[model samples]
Target: MMRANENARGRLSWKVAHRAIPFALLLLAAAALFHFSVEVGEGDTLAWDQAFLLSLRHADDVALPLGPAWITTAMVNFTSLGGVTVLLFITLTTIGLLLISRRPVEALFLCVALVGGWLSSNTLKLWAARPRPDVVTHLVAVGDASFPSGHAMVSAATYLALAIVACRFLRAPAQKAYVFVIAGSLIGTIGLSRIYLGVHYPTDVLFGWCAGSLWTFGSWLLFRRFLPSQA
Candidate 1:
């Protein structure tokens, strides 16, 4: 029965690979981010970070970004979407909705994920203590360390966590995909706006995105059982 055994082994391998692919990718991404974070912490990326930050500004004047006036204004507006006031309002409104709908468990999960994510973001900034890019003028005011962008991290955690919870109530695959796409687009735009505005280095936003995503995903896994099932 050698042939039969080989067929069974192939089927087992296929099943294992199918189940392992996503986890493998996630693990690799996390490892890469960690390595990059270390490099950043050791000041090994300073040269490239400064070069990249300056590339977005005109060589003649760092204050003038590499775009028209209207684009600068638009970036400012987009940046606010990830600001404290907007995120706070959204978080409160979401919690209210969940409570009213008798989904206390889901509400609690959102609270833990978002609140914990915020604290983690702040902690990372303090730990890294990476200064904001001095190679270019910051279009907006910023007073915190810039290793991990607070706006990017918080926005990714908030939007992605919300999207995950929202997708639970969606019955169709298209609807779920739409929710995810919107969330991802918002996160990407917010992160890019920070860089364009000269308030953060690209690496700061990149690390923020990675850390925020991992935190939210970890929170989801921890609370997935308590979250509502799909419609």
Candidate 2:
């Protein structure tokens, strides 16, 4: 029994140790992406961006992305997850679920994280004032600056932040893994959908992911300290 307990404790310690490594890397990666976004916005990535965006298109028919019509249709649907309307729906639903579970303070923290990320994305868009992709015809219409894909940033912030909350509700390893996997898949696919539709450059989505992740995790660190009684 003592040996089994020690083995369980060792596994727990290992999980904690591995978790710390990624958190440290997240901070570093966020800084790196922000720096590169600044450089790209200033025209340093002109050749690379054009090359990358064009690669995703058919050579003979550059207007269309290099995929079947149905795939394009599916990508459009997936991309909507990052759109304002869809994101708002997700936000409201998550808040409702948290309140139902008697986690009001955590729900509030979730709201703050999401709102802050959205505002930051918009502010950065104005500051950068970068133009939308001209490499190919956009599968969907978009209006506004495109230095960072708002859809990418906002979805990543919301979904990933929700994963942190999910960890609290899910105790079993399989349940926790499933929750994180779904959340991560949504975050990744939403970002890719923007690039696939020719609405955002690859760099734009990349930076958005970085910024969103940094903000989400940072908020979690703050809110986790708010004990239930204090909350």
Candidate 3:
């Protein structure tokens, strides 16, 4: 039993290191990009993207309402019905799954990741303080500073975290890929929904996605390092 425990510890350490290195690099890259967006790209280019999305958001007579309608509906669902509520639900679900599977450490790690991501997103939002797109009137009321979109950030974190948790039990490469693809699709859909609904500019969504992804991986790395192996 001691030998088995030692072996498990060694494996966990290696796994933690392997997962952490790339995420650390990614965090560095995101920090650089965030700085660039704030220092250089915040004026004309950002304005143009905002205007473009606004045009699409306000296009009522553009002939193909179906695409926009579907996207808008999704945006509404993501913004209102699903949004933060779904994130909380997923967090709780992760906790429940971990408890059921007898992995309390992993469950606690997931909870921290979720809460940490949210806190980080809000902090960045306040720091950036970029305004929202001024396209057709905003479909939904939002007061937070823009730049890194909250919806996009939260959606990315939640879905990507879900994918990570799901991948923990999956052994097949194809299965892992499938999980990532589904998560990616959901994240992409949510980001696009924000743009289509005129609440966020394309850049805002892009930055938010980057930030959220960076944070998710970073959090995973942190958890892997500290999570107990008793379970």
lDDT of each: 0.87, 0.86, 0.73
User: Could you tally the backbone clashes for each prediction?
Assistant: 0, 0, 0
**Pairs clashing within candidate 2:** none
lDDT of 1 by residue, 84-196 (tens): 78887998899899999988877887887688778998998888888888889999999999989989999998889899889878888999999999999999999999999
Which candidate number maximizes lDDT?
Answer: 1
| Runs of candidate 3 exceeding 4 Å displacement | 1-24, 55-68, 80-82, 226-231
Model 2 accuracy (lDDT, Cα): 0.86
Stretches of candidate 1 exceeding 4 Å from the true structure: 1-31
Positional deviation of residue 160's Cα in model 3 after best superposition, in angstroms: 0.9
Looking at model 2, report the run of 10 residues with the lowest lDDT sum.
Answer: 222-231
Angstrom error at residue 71, model 3: 3.9
CA shift of 184, model 1, Å? 0.7
Which has the higher lDDT value, candidate number 1 or candidate number 3?
1
Highest-scoring model, TM-score: 1
